[model samples]
Target: KLSPPLPLPPLPPKPIPKPRPLPPPSFLSAVHQGNNDWWRYLMAVGLIGSVFFVLTAALSTLALGLGWISLAPDGSVTIRDPLVSYLLSHLPFGFLGLGLWWAVVGLHHRPCRTLIRACGSLRWGRMAQGAAIWLALIISPLAVALLLNPGSLMPQVDWNQWLRLLGLAMVLTPMQIAVEELFFRGYLLQASGLLTQKPWILCLVNGILFMIVHLDNPETGYGLGWLALYYAGFGIFTTWITLRDQGLELALGMHAANNGFVILLVSYGDAVVETPALFSATSFDAAGVVLAFAVRALGFCALFFGIPGLRRDSVPPLQPQGSASEKPPGS
Candidate 1:
């Protein structure tokens, strides 16, 4: 009976699935991936900065020549229309973006996509998700405000003006937002990595520098200290997200959504980029602005990171090299 119960034929060998390839490391590796020469980095900066300044000066002159803007006798500038001025101001961003593209490819000798994401491609799905979530987070508060105090939002633009602003912003706002992300969080962040790999150190340095540049924004009139904190906080937030996600896709989407909402749906009296928004707020409570920013930052972090599926697949936090935060410059 035991002999008759001879063992059944051996089961067929199971197939082993091939492991998927990992995405290239965070953008922090970009500089190390290419020529990390200090001089080349400096030259790239000079090139883009020059392009921005020259375009700004030339545009201002042309605007004056065309009677679009005027210089007051007391060294003040008068804008013909806030919407026109805003659109014109965003023009330089386009040129600066091109210059940056050239510098990365020509000077750094790396694919320009290196500046976008390490895998050399934009994750459109990620960008869209980021935009949707960010837009929802911002619009929900305004929706509540509308429900509680409809009068708080005063109609500011007629149909025609609103349409014009929408068209221009649809084309230009994304460009402005993308260029800023490329320059600050993309180029500058990578350059800074050559010196130190500490995310906090990179965030602080970038945030301070970002705030310094934005000090010229009209919102500073609200309260220099509060606005400064707000800008620095935003800078820090964006940089942090960039570190977490390993690229600028999420940051780009969030920035575009924030700016688009401000420039299209609702605007404040002293917004830097004026828009023929559907509604306007004559005044903003400074303290409320800071508190709202804090709340929004926390909420964004929670929703972005708390959801298991939302996180980039198996991305690790960017860590300092050599077990220390600081390293010798160029090391």
Candidate 2:
């Protein structure tokens, strides 16, 4: 061997691999498992509308004939028993739920659970956490309001009526909330995602649609603009959370709690879903209501995102379930 072998040249530096891009959030990407033709969505919409209209008209006629509901000269509706009215108002949602299932599962051939969560199941624990957070945010302000103006607390129902209302609310309120969550945040939001990947864009469009849906609500009397903004804001908030969590459980829980509180604890004049609430406000405070909403929205986001273990989507990348009729694109 040669006395002096040249030292081996220094090895070249290894190339750093570029990080793989992350997949879209499961709540949006869930749509990939199904056929996404525009006409299919239109069919789903038509089905939902037809189902809702038929159910509402039939129920209204029956309620009027039964003397359970009355119409005033100005077209204001009065329900004889708030509990029965709640049932009437919420019953359509049960049918609508079926229509939605048919739309997502039957028409689109997508797994139904994908409409609710990426994991193909409902996370009851996540829902309960969301409910607790919403309750705390709402109750805090109500407590403060009562302390400031005790006179505003006018009792609206006896304990017996409240007990009955509670029972009905425990059943009907969640049903109503689930349908809404499934439609707007689940179906509509995913549809919108097909066109854009921007979170803000998705949230903005969802908000506008939600506002339009609520345009006919009795709360519009507070000021059409204010109510519109309020409804839109709620949509944005819920949609944002849905995107963040990659599921509808949090939204469902929060919505259920909000409606339950209004229906069972406190209500005001011109409420859409009349209930035998424990207390009624003599005057509507539109500004205060909006402010409280803003506060709650901020608190909810901060707490949910900042706290460990509060996020549901932190586990793993979304995996399409075998139940999907079509294999997801690029899988």
Candidate 3:
């Protein structure tokens, strides 16, 4: 009776469930969140990036002129000495350029990681996931295609030179790919994004720049425009994922894995890179190769972009640490 009577007194209402906290905003979101004048971003990211790259190019040219590093008249680095070749491939992406990007980001009181990833730091986990996906999706497919067309592969290698090349690829290729990513996806994306939040615009601009940079690459038979298209497409695919995921970890991982594999397993023609990969593409059906590449890339994008809660799209405490008004004075 007492319990029944007590039940008459309604139980206290249950508390409302609090929503899970959202992580901090990524640079894509940050740029949008900030009330920045489009130009401020351009200067912070684009201007700085351009200056650094130009400076580096001049330095690289100086190195070539001085014979510190050998280069073809067309301005491509010649791989005569294993060590010099490694340096040439890696120099552009090295501290000279990337460090300047980092420094510029810091100049505006933003962490370099913000330019590089939404997490404001390098997320190794995301990178690994991306690398794994690239290997499974793209690298594996390329291997299968090569197997199906064995004649496309280049002449057999001397294990000694091949082994040395393998080491070079493992060590230097990552640096080269990383440099490219930082320039294209990191500073370039961030700076350009300030102009417009539209993903397609960003994709085209970044993609074209990427393709242009490879103009001197000797990869032939695919036709220059077609090759450039492929490069642009690759850039678009990567930028798409980077923007969607709100970080560069996946892009870096994917590129590193893709280029690493290509450099170690196969390369051919006036391909910008001349690695001692196990095989070379002596005969590539450009259309088939490009189509196959696109298919694999699409698959990669779906997996990397489709996952939920794999990681925060941005770091936490989402208040606008990036407000343009908040941009450091004269930054």
Model 2 Cα lDDT, one tens digit per residue, 1-331: 6598889999999999999877444777788889999899999999888888888899889989998989999999877787787788788888898889889997899997788875578889989989899988888867776788787778866888888878877887888888888989988888888888778888889999988878888767877776677788889999888877788989988888888778887777777776778877677766656667887889898788865666444544323323200000000
Residue-by-residue lDDT tens digits, candidate 1, 1-331: 3456767899999999999887576678877667878898789889988987898889888988989888989999888687777778799899899889878888988887787787678889878877888788777886787787777778876888888788888898988988888889988888888888889999999899888988888777768887788778778988998888888888888888878877887777766776678877755765567677677768887787877766555667656754100000000
lDDT of candidate 3 at residue 242, scale 0 to 100 = 80
Task: Find the 10 residues in a row with the least total lDDT in model 3.
Answer: 322-331
In model 2, the runs with Cα more than 4 Å from the true position are 1-25, 71-78, 308-331
Best-to-worst order by TM-score is 1, 2, 3
Clash count for candidate 3 is 7
Q: Cα lDDT for residue 247, model 2?
A: 85
The candidate that achieves the highest TM-score relative to the unseen native structure: 1
lDDT of 3 at 44: 55
lDDT string, candidate 3, 55-92, tens digits: 67887777778777775689765556544554565666
TM-score of 3: 0.74
Clashes of each: 0, 0, 7
